[model samples]
Target: MSGGGFSRLPNGTVVVAVSLPSPLGDGSVARFLVHAANRARALTRLRNLGLRAVYLRGNAEPPTPDEITAVLHHPDGLLWRLQGAPAAELWHPFRSSSPLRNRWA
Candidate 1:
């Protein structure tokens, strides 16, 4: 869990959770997120984990090329930039379970 890499669930799913340090500072909390794989091999690794797919959540944004390189090189030095807004603004209130369903409709 301490390693800076993806983990597998019991269901053969490749889960890349962002295990960045806690307390991102400035009254905001850092959240761990699952990263998706665009490569077929990475997806296969997920399947090997006995999972059909991994669960990804939160308002985490995709890392930029430079950020990715930084993570690949020195994950411990990974630092994310604040967009100067609340994460809730990206999605509606999750009163119901199927929040995204209504969003698509």
Candidate 2:
């Protein structure tokens, strides 16, 4: 599971997740989710290279809106890396008060 998955939002933000191998049962899915978040950290490092945005699908819950907010607003979060132009705006517009118009605006 290295190729990972990509979800391009309507706002132009790209949500990327690591593709961890599923074990065989419920535990597999759970571990995949955990690994997804763990891999998110690795992906964060790529922000400096124009890969700032990511989305973690760790479980059926799809991560809380607040949890996502915390990640984006964290001191060293993705937002910090997307300061200028060209950074991948990896934010979820569905949770925002105003919806996004496209994925590359």
What is the Cα-based lDDT of residue 67 in candidate 2?
A: 35
Residue 53's lDDT in candidate 1:
40
Clashing pairs in model 1, backbone N/Cα/C closer than 3 A: 11-49, 11-50, 11-51, 12-46, 12-49, 12-50, 12-51, 13-51, 14-46
| lDDT of candidate 2 over 1-105, digit per residue (tens) | 223343333565443433332233332211111112344454654433333343444433333343344444544333221112243544332212322212212
Give all candidates' CA lDDT scores: 0.34, 0.33
> Local error of candidate 2 at 86, Å?
37
Tens digits of lDDT, candidate 1, 1-105: 111345443556333433222233355323222333332454343344333443334424444443344334442322233233464433122122433223322
lDDT of 1: 0.34
Task: Tell me the number of clashing residue pairs for each predicted model.
Answer: 9, 8
Which parts of model 2 have CA positions greater than 4 angstroms off?
A: 20-105
